[model samples]
Target: MIKSCAVLGEQFVFRSLKEIMAKANEARSGDELARIAASSMKERMAAKQVLANLMLKEIREYPVLSPEQDDVSALIEEQVHEEIFKVIQNWTVADLREYVLEDQHEGADLLYIAKGLTSEMIAAVTKIMSNLDLIQAASKIEVKTTCQTTIGMKGVLASRAQPNHPSDNLAGMRASLYEALSYGIGDAVIGINPVIDTTENIYALLNETKSIIDEFQIPTQNCVLAHVTTQMRAIEKGASADLIFQSLAGTQAGNESFGISLSMLKEATALINEKGTAVGPHRWYFETGQGSELSAEAHYDIDQVTLEARCYGLARQFNPFLVNTVVGFIGPEYLYDSKQVTRAGLEDHFMGKMHGLPMGVDVCYTNHMNVDQNDMDNLSMLLGTAGVNFVIGVPMADDCMLNYQSLSYHDIATVRRILNQGPISIFKQWLEEYGIMENNRFTSKAGDPSIFMNGVLGGMK
Candidate 1:
């Protein structure tokens, strides 16, 4: 139809749907489907094949493209609602499971509950699909993985803070956190990797972090990226720790590197629960990447992606506040190059999200690898659309201390803009209030500092 916001308007949407259906049927392969769609729309992704095929399958019986029907809007809604209701009423869980298996994909039915299925439909939908199978299919859509993650958390588009200081010093920590806020990221949790392990440092770090929140007057929380035992000690010393962050591997030796065991993780969680109400409710942050298993020599010959997913399983047991796959942050030894690195990012993201862990991806890369902004750009878009919880928004996509390039604040902004999503909902309003954002959108001198300076040049002395 017409190029306007009308694309989102119900009537226009229906027209576009008809257009897509007609075009899709004329296409043959997935490539053809993409080409045909893009001839009118912009570039359609390969995934369009799955959707196109579904559309074609449904529309084949209606050889007539009649626009004569009165009240197309009601017709569209009724047809969609009826189809959904039929799926629930006509198929058993076993049948749905069989359909998924036979087709070998499309677990989107799992999101039926979220997509507007009524209570009556749900009551009849005892078996839309097996919970376990649905989770698996959600992960496998784009990534080769098995597991699930907590997709939505805190009633917001899940996000987080990652600040790594070379010295883990207070000043540097404050700077990183401030910079993160400048980009409008304060909703999730602020976590810092403390290079120094002393209780004094951890305790002081925690308090100063609390001060940062008070200074900014924001409803945010802080955490220290230290060993669980070290964090526990700091907590015992009265530090206001909000999250217990850990890195895990599937194998015993791999996990030992981080001094994390299932029992130990459980104990730490229980200890936090018993201590006090300083930290509200609960929090657990876990980091996993494809190369870590092989790096630890704990692969036991299993593939990195599979082992990485197993790490997701481990984190899920703790009810993770955040489970992120630092996609390419590990380096070249294990992931090889950007192609493999990019693929692993999607895999880890899918796996974490499958297990119901609040999932995000540290869309990043190491200098030693054959990668650049383009690699991360592509991966970030994939993650955004796949709805992987969140991403790390470090300065310049560079972690001076960690020695890797990560998603820049601009990367986050770009993805959020494309997805038409705002940062952690409440914080979005706060950002606008503080003028960091305008109208729920990030405001900035986006490209170069020089460009921003260009406007003010006339006033300069």
Candidate 2:
């Protein structure tokens, strides 16, 4: 029965071909042939209605939560409704029949129908259909509605953990971040720490880093770096900086404190500005990994708002010209916490105030906590939605590595046969076709040599 339904669905694609050809080959005047074609097309339309009703009925029998049944039914119904509506609203039967009979009809109708479907609809349908086998592979786990509601109410900390290994993770993260920056994916700010801790061999590292940045040639407005610090000088240096700074909740140790480390940053910014080789217009330097204290959080919030106001006070700063970048850090404890107040506070403040600055977070470092795969998935999706412009790619991270695999779908058959291969790769290929794959790169070879520039930066011109 299932096989028959599948066959029928496939048959629908070619159902009108025979009638179309018959009308084209009929021995009659053009007008008479067109009339006959219209009548025949009407009959075929009636049959399609029946087929649509049958498909919908079959769909209704399956549970709403059932993936296969719901997805197939939804897709069929959506297609049928769209096609029928176009026939009724725009095309005469003769026009459709003629288009159908021809080897090419320009594909305008198909494109129109495709555009009518929303992203949400496609995602929902894909999720339902793709998870069918997984549903069977894993035993069902049920949670009470109350429990689900409670989970939903919790903050970012209640979220799952990330991969272990700071260096490896940072590599992957840097890739993701680079990708995001290149493509203008979301809200992002790239922060650079220009000064290395030790003076012994710092010149090489700084030069290397600068060389890399120059090679990439990304817009200077999108990047900023912090200053170097010394143990005793750090305190005064941190306290004396003119710009406001913010950092992550929980993780600060010793001389690595958040608010008090600005003096060094000030020196760095001043030197870089004077040198004219540094990327600046630097108004802020966010401290990543500072343990959360209520006092600290409040101070952070006040400082951010105050800085924004100051920028505005200086010169229509509230307008679009004020270039600023806020660097944030995400770790296991923060992801696993039940109350994500710190994340929420920063989000609320920065989201509205920094109208034009690119904002992002670095998740390359390892947390001393456990994180699951699902957590990573959720975090990615969440950040994508939260106006996060760039994410450090998993493959670029030092810890988590990508397999650098590629798959080709040369035709419809290949697409239909895709089973466990996630749709992400398929979409990436589509993006590549349009030259939009920089941020969507799934494989290492997919990198584009051109530096990604944001539309906003271009708009400045």
Candidate 3:
């Protein structure tokens, strides 16, 4: 079917809803590479005009992929609350956008709206939103989840201690963890991206991080970013994992490329719920990024943003404790540079929050990307302001193993103070116990990792 709209007396016709979605997006290299981006600015506007008038029911009916052909699509269809959907089914995309921006419809209202939307409808609204539009609307919604500790509270920003080592060296990782802890970061989880994705290496890293938590009595969780199956295998072999980690995609074929499936995720969740050490459910950690589906050649001609939203659609079903978009790690081919990266970061955060998931972002870039620490700084502050659940903290904003740049411990601490936010409540109490923080601000002894070594700071001891 064809969709047509007129802009300033110029008629433009889009081949399908999928094409309209691609055309409506802000300039993205991946969309251009996929040859789905609009050929001209006028054409893009026309697409947006058509999309803005599209009914929620129409978007739901013309899914980019049919449910029978794609399990991800099926899952999304299965989760929509029919009673809720029927109420707002006639609303236009423009109406949905205005509703989110409206002051009266807040976090609870948005969560209710989320149950009535599919990933496509969410993507449709995002395509029409500007950066500030994304931020302002996202700030109104707060999605909190808990595993070992509760995160995503209002006026709180969390950080993941990514103590990654090039060789999976436990001591080296620990040194980074200490630095993160000293700065009162890592309240979300102590996670590692292992160089070796083997079960043995994953098991060892999980045990090492769990041991650190046990020894220090830290109110946090631990995880290794290996394949979900490998994490499951390690857990079966007696690895004490606080959360099982996996990277998700929006399509069945894309997930297949990642060696995951709906059934695999179901199995992993059940395993963690039973054997994992976390309390009160919400024990899964998932990561996503734009262009992953295209990179795997499984995108089916849909735009990256919509596929990215679908990733969140898949994640919400399992009640994940954490889900972040590694915004710039996909590099120049997809995100192109800092501007694109920044846009994607904001988009991912807003989309995830709209899905009612506890969302965060890995504010990072590869070495080859036309990005630097300044861009990371800007994006982090924006996301922090938008009430993101957490951000990744590596040593000095650099991950030695992953070979990328992200927020550092010091950077996170600085952001928290500037934004008048702090870590999770339990983690803040622990920080106070060690004198690392006082009155929602860092003390003189904050930056020294040695405080944890002695189990007590100077005044207490």
Candidate 4:
């Protein structure tokens, strides 16, 4: 079993990853590289990450090697890794950031990706920086986030209700919205992912969401997680898609796989502006994760975290209202387990915040990994203290539709209670009316069946 920091004792099963790295460093020739790479792919060992570790360690410790670099250099670049080697070979942190910022005439592409092809590069660069550096970077970027409860202000965190339903089921969605509001979440936004159909289905979901927001007079907006184009179509037909949701990557291939590109993002931005809503000038909600580029084969050999930052830069171009990194949702193939997940979660949060984005953490894990509740709880508290914009709110962090566990409403409440943070003012008022919350502390069972809960539950039958 690989031993990672977050998961220890009898529950851990991956063994000591440090030992594997020690073994992996022994590959000194092209033949060994080929052998290890092949073995790792064929399931002979889970130590494939050792290749990345070695490469990142070399880059972090040494300057650009001349043509007479060590044999491991050549071995590292053999075939499969050649793409990544070329991108990161001689690059430093500043160099990578410059590459991301250069204008089109200066060789910058429509998409400026500085991260996510490799995990090690980000790990390496971040390793060298202190917490003060990260804090300053975040402060320097300076993006403004606005929600109804804290209008005319910046630096607010909002909870979003991510409900996925088969088509537009009013009863089902009503319950989901009620669940979120009952817990004082979703002051930022309440959005849903339609299973298949985009236009009509999304239209229905948005309409229901709009109704909920209106009935409560809540200071929140609604969103449908459809493709930008599909959402554009819905808006053109008069559906209320107050927020645009999309998953972004650093590479063109990754964006294309998600049916989004830089040009498309621009068009969507313009389109949303044309079809204005109460949500105001800032209206893009983007979800980014590490390993998405590798998963989509679009990373072109870059580090995932840097790629994520580049993705943030792309979204920043349009002045996005929110961007969240589903840090551990991608599973163990990339993050390995909770230790890596914990590290990556903090890194992504730092990068996004550093780049002036309203960042939220989906401090979550998949069932297949070695992660446990302790890991999620720890990450939640850590991020909450860091002042993240929001976290995911599902029942027990378990999205039955998405088949992954994430930040539960209870988790959000626990963190909020501990930090003495309450939801946005209006949503907090609603919670107070329902007896669900009093003085920013979750009332638990003390919340009697108030008229608010009765009205919300009245339609549940």
Q: How do all models score by TM-score?
A: 0.65, 0.34, 0.98, 0.70
Candidate 4 wrongly placed segments (more than 4 Å): 1-127, 130-143, 147-157, 166-168, 433-435, 443-453, 456-461
lDDT by residue (tens digit), candidate 2, 1-461: 02112232332222332232222221212213123332344443443332222222232232222224333223323333454444433332233223322444322342343233221221111111112221221111111111101111111111111122233234343444444333322112233332333332233323333343344443322222333333213323222221222332221222233433324444544543444332234444343322232224322211221122222111112111122222122333332321232232233223222222223333332334343333344333343333332233322333322221111111111221232111223333433443544443333322332323232222221
Q: What would you estimate as the lDDT of candidate 4?
A: 0.59
Q: Could you give candidate 1's per-residue lDDT for residues 303-377 as a string of tens digits? A: 354346456656655666667788777677666567766666655655555444567788888888888988889
The sequence of per-residue lDDT tens digits that candidate 4 reaches over residues 323-345 is 88888887877776777777677
Which numbered prediction scores highest in lDDT against the true structure? 3
Segments of candidate 3 deviating more than 4 angstroms: 454-456, 459-461
Ranking of predictions according to TM-score: 3, 4, 1, 2
Q: Per-residue lDDT for 15 in model 3?
A: 76
Sliding window of 10 residues with minimal summed lDDT for model 2: 143-152
Which lDDT values do the candidates have, in the order given? 0.55, 0.28, 0.92, 0.59
Angstrom error at residue 102, model 1: 10
Ten contiguous residues minimizing lDDT sum, candidate 3: 452-461
Candidate 3 accuracy as lDDT: 0.92
**C-alpha lDDT (0 to 100) for residue 223 of candidate 1:** 74
Candidate closer to the true structure by TM-score (higher is better), 1 or 3:
3
